[model samples]
Target: MSTTPRIEVAAVADALYGKWKEERLAGRALASDPRLQTIPGQSMDEHRERVLEQLGLLVEAGAIQRAFPKHLGGSDNHGGNIAGFQELVFADPSMQIKSGVQWGLFGAAILHLGTEHHHNTWLPDVMSLKLPGAFAMTEIGHGSDVASVGTTATYDPETEEFVIHTPFKGAWKEFLGNAALHGQAAVVFAQLITNGVNHGVHAFMVPIRTPDGQMMPGIGSEDDGVKGGLNGIDNGRLHFTNVRIPRTNLLNRYGDVAADGTYSSHIESPGRRFFTMIGTLVQGRVSLDGAAVNAMKGALAIALRYGSERRQFSGADGKEVVLLDYGHYQRRLLPRLAETYAMQFADHKLLETFDEVFSGANDTDENREDLETLAAALKPLSTWAALDTLQEAREATGGAGFIAKNRLTGWRADLDIYVTFEGDNNVLLQLVGKRLLTEYAEQFKDGDVAAIAKVVAGQIGEGAARFGLRQMGQSIADLGKVARSVEGVRDPETQQALLADRVQTMVAQIAM
Candidate 1:
């Protein structure tokens, strides 16, 4: 904490929090609108039709344009934009994700990672949905391993263009949210090679579908017709057969290929340069973090309210019992309720840090790293929680929940895909785990092994104090039995430290 005024934070939080309420209202508008709701067992064409229609509704409502530049007539307030954008999950996750494919991934790739020249060249159409786009990063064989993607963007000095090609099937981009149908363009990522030097992965704007809905000459696509869920999205695959675009097509805020085809960049180290490029696109994870939390709240509000009203087996009064009155019911729901409350606070903190870094209030490299770690941490937790909460809510409502009429079953089915998008939950958590190890390893990088050992030993002693002195090894202990300091460990900051510490602890224990 800097010595910033408490009132400043609260005032900002109040305004942003109200945006979430407005987002909820947006959800209600869509849910009642019928045009946006998902129909069960809908065919691929029907799904595509509904998805395109809903995306148009979202654009017409101005719900999908919140994150653009004010010079371009957007609000340009980063925090408020995300707050409102996240509520789209309630109507349909497919709509939310396909909208994200167009705006958050594609438009943001231009807004954040592109130069003003690139923005002026392409963003007007992209922002207006006239150039609806795909984020073509996840390839068929390289889902999480972006660096290993075989799609190549080789510079051609003769044409002053970058020749991008998918020479192998494994290099073809897959599972793209809008590739099959509506996308007119894509923010394509390929390994950038210029002057015989590999410059790591970078983004390029590629026109895929023509304005008349035909695939472009060098681009080929196949629809991933039906999915386990999120069937409303036209998930598809893309292959480029020597697609050529102007060298200026590279979204080169982080790295550039000059007219001479020599690679140059602001960040020196390839590792740092790669992370910087990817970090620019991290609003994907950031939005997912907030959306997952909102989804959980939706699940809980519906289930808890319904659970309270829903009557179960008969009681002595010859009336059915409220489902929530059962201990088993509370046992199933309360822990998730606790998780949702805690995660809402965590989401706010993540949003504050995101605004701080992106708004340049705290744009230090350290702050950016912190923001990424916070996103990686909270995103995994919230997505997994959303899936778990939705499942529990579905079961809690019994067959009524299973029906589409009540919305629980549909919400459950839709949210199933969230755990896999933005990044898989397991993969995101593993990234967090790696970051934690690096943080701990830094403690000893200054030739101060004793200090690192002492720090680790000190933490172990504290853990022992809480477990041994506080609990006395008993099967049960009162919640108040521990010292206030020990219990303060439950605070979010303390929880963050322990989670990091546990990662370090596991690494250390493994090494020993």
Candidate 2:
């Protein structure tokens, strides 16, 4: 007789879900809050305002301040804060993304990139939602190419302020959350010019609107209108024409300017300094990784429960079998379930590493680079996985999933843009490829020429393996007899070797 596999599901769930106890509890409470529930049939404008109200509720619950400094009435619990924030996807994706824009990007720019003066002056209003803002980094012309932005912040020595301007239409800050209507200020990124010399890119806190909702002079914006998803956010574009702010407005953790218009950075290389400033914003990607995983979990929970209780056809015993009992249905969900469990463990590890780096426990250049690379790699996978899983879950549920109240379609729609945000998936993969090559080159720096040549040959072999040319060659040598393809594919050792070999080959090709 055959026996089923024995596993401790509760133990595994607790292990994966209990990493940040207090934060997870807060998330669960928020998920269950009746006031935060999504209202069916609400218009786009109503949804946007509803999400804003939900943000206020999050502030009242003290759930959004955990990641800020402890002196500013926050817990300074970076990892826990992300863990809690990601879980809000369960309540409503629009609300989750809107809150992320408010705190993770806008507020985080001030907290992570700016100094104590900024923290003391702005964080209180930010944490309390008294001052809504946007993180305006992406430009119409320079989406992923942040370093080449055309917006300029020219230092004026006579006035001791920086004049911010969009040199052309493409230079306008585009697709900024909270920018269309709600944002009163923004952390605008522009190329810094001082003493007639360019200093790469830096962030400046610019007030865009007054408390009464009127645009400030020299600042103009237009609403993005209805988007395909995440309509709860007031996405918009911003343009500046000689908008001047005090020189002290620069978030100068990495680069600074003097009263005499002398620009200096602690890191001598402008390229390195720019990267360091951008690295501080890695928390956005980290939080997205966790959120994608949880979204997969939420969708799976609904689908699997419905499948177990649902029956379609009658069996030999004159009773209908549960939908999950069908082999095709099992194939659709069981593998996904296994992958989701793996992602849960992987996401927890990523969150822990993020906390270690941000909390100053393991802060180092190598660790930060590792954290950034891991986030880049994992966010793409998890977000892609989420969209795929939600789509499959929707199909599996048949007409039930189509109903708006079931949330499958909503989940899929809200998550679609995740592939394009924080960092575009393709762009992020390119970063990973570059980093791998850099590390690989460093390892062989002192090696013999013969050894390096041998490594190059081995990489070629990997590429050859991917093409199945080796198998064809063996078949020719064997006089039309080839090895069993299924047997080779089923071998675990062979599968691992094939995957590793293929990845190495792709990276090598990209490097060339």
Candidate 3:
């Protein structure tokens, strides 16, 4: 008889579902509805229209309001909102992204960056789909360098308005969702200049189109046409020419301007103020991390289910061998399965930290900084892993995976942009590396001479160990005993110590 215990499916599922089980189940139920699911072979224009209609359905279902304030008909449930939102990947990645553009980006800017007056003026319409909008932060000339964007919002004290202008073609906002057709307004990011002094990047509410879909004066838009994927989004470019809005239109939670063109902010350092404003929008990365993990789960489930049933060749007993029974197949898929589980757990932890900061339960500056760094580090890894897993799953399923109806190819195309959008993977990893160096340097900031000497001595010891000067005795004892060397690393604690030592050595070298 086999000694292994039977698996408890229900208990395992409950644990895997994390703290927000009900919200995730609700989202999954909605995603299973045919009306909201993707139609594989639809035309680009048809897909775009279908997604727009689906956004309305989401509003009717009350699926997009959980993150807003309770006074505005929302639950103020930050973590649960993301838990639910991530499940939309099952319906369609395009739909998930389009909905994110509206509620997660555009509406969130108003909620986090703007004051109560601005929220009351715009958020209700935004929640109801009465006012579709765009988040215009990336320009043709500036994608990751948001601090140096070319668009300018020059304040005019005489008329008490800000003149928003795109001085050159490079200043035009590019790749904005909803800008081509449906957007009626946009939260535009530009350098704020008042009294001939540039006060760095700030956001403002600017009308881009009329209610009936006419482009507003001084605002020009151009369609991006068919893309490699996610055609359901009406991505486009927008340019401004002397477009003017009221001074009060500035989202002034971080920084503000007076009627006489004087700039003031509670945060004195311009650099600190800019980072604080941008950090509030870190939920974009947090949500993307979860969505990518969900996508990895979907891909693995499809591939593993197919692999278990499909058979090939014959065994010695003359029965066909199931694909998954082969060691080679197991090698290919099982490690990815393990990685997907790890990513999901990491995402859950990230979501918990996010809830802590945003819910004001532990909203200290240090906690916020930790949240930002965590998101920056994890988003890149999960998204890249999702792409790798999806491709492997597709290849594992053979001819069936290539078929449109199987959803692998379409999903791969849709998720290709996730690595670059919220923040480029390379750029985000650089941020994490910088944060690591900063943390390392902080220990030496107090000029503790004794502590510095100790660290220097430790580095010298590590160098000696690396060069075999200190490990010579152990090497001589272990010579000609490869199994003994391998046995040492077989212990988990030894493996962890080696890895931790490697990281500390590399970081110390970089810091010096």
Candidate 4:
């Protein structure tokens, strides 16, 4: 009798669906609805308008309110909120990102950075789609270095207001989602200058347009015309020429300015305060990570299904072979399929950490730092993997994948920006690297030689085991022949040990 391994489909699916399975399924149902799906070949203007309409549909379906406070009509289920939000990639990446811009960035800035007054005044409108806004943080001069953005919010004690200004061309806010047309307001980030003290970067609620669609005084808007992808979002630039907003417009949860122009913050260090405020908005990266994974899943689904059915050249038996039955075809997509599963579980873990921190259940400085580092580390890998997987899947399907209707080409184009936005992938990884170094240094800071020796010894053992030294010993012990390294490499524990050792080696090298 011969034995063959069998997969439990339902069990695997349940594991992949994760803790927020119901929310993900609900999002999938919404994504599957024809009204919300993307129409290939639509012009930029048409696509933008269609996506805007879809936002209203989402509001009606009550799909955009999960992250808000329950008293304000949301369920406050932060993890579930993201799980559902990520599924929008199946419908349209543009819609997913645009919604993220509105709620996840703009409104979330107010919710997390602002006080209760700002929330009571703004979040209701935000949740209902009645007030569309832009998150004006990225300037032409600054992308990842947000703390150094050229825009300024200078205090005016005489007028009791903060005058928001883009002093130079470089300071103009660029690539904002709603600035091209629909945004009536923006959460503008700028250096807060109060009482002649430069108090680092801060967010201010600045109205850019009136209800009648006219630009507010001292505010100029320019449309960012067609680009590589996500044109469904009205990406545009905004500049402020001493635009005055009320003193109360400062979203000052982390730092605040008094009416007398005195700046005060719970965190005394300007850098720490800025990071704490920014860390509150880590949801963007969290959602993008999951969205990228979802995109990979969709692409693989299309390619794998097509490969299993679409017949190609003749096989050994002289019948036209199914594409998936070919060795090279499986080689091309199976690894990506496995990687997507890994990314899915990784994203779920990240989401759980985000919920723990945001929900205040496990909100601690250490945990917040861990969450940020985890997001920074995983987001780049997943997004880059998504692009790679999508492209490979496209190529595997041959001409059929290139066709617009199949979604591979369109998704590849749209997701091209993922690796760069929500903090550029390279920059994010640099942050992760920095954190790893900091943690590594802390272990040695206490000058415990025994502890250091143990750590070094453990790393050496791991390195030796992974690099064949221990395996060589095992082969010699078994007989005078080398053991099959491939079999050991396939073991889960061995694979993990190898990866961990590699990271340790790199970190040790850098520290030295």
Number of the top candidate by TM-score?
4
lDDT of each candidate versus the true structure = 0.80, 0.89, 0.92, 0.92
Order of quality (TM-score): 4, 3, 2, 1
| Structural similarity to truth (TM-score) of each candidate | 0.88, 0.90, 0.93, 0.95
The whole-model C-alpha lDDT of candidate 2 against the native structure comes to 0.89
- For candidate 2, list the clashing residue pairs, or say none: none
Error of 2 at 256 (Å): 0.8
- Ranking 1 against 3 by TM-score, winner: 3
Where does model 2 exceed 4 Å of error? Answer: 1-4, 450-512
lDDT of 4 by residue, 227-250 (tens): 899989999999999889999999
Candidate 2: residue 264 lDDT (0-100): 80
lDDT tens per residue, model 1, 221-303 = 99887777788778899999998999999999998888988888889998888888889777888888888887888888888
| Weakest lDDT window of 10 consecutive positions for candidate 4 | 463-472
lDDT of 4 at 68: 96
In model 2, the worst 10-residue window by lDDT is 466-475
Query: Ten residues in a row with the worst lDDT in model 3?
Result: 467-476
Off by over 4 Å in 1: 1-32, 460-512
Better of 2 and 3 by TM-score: 3
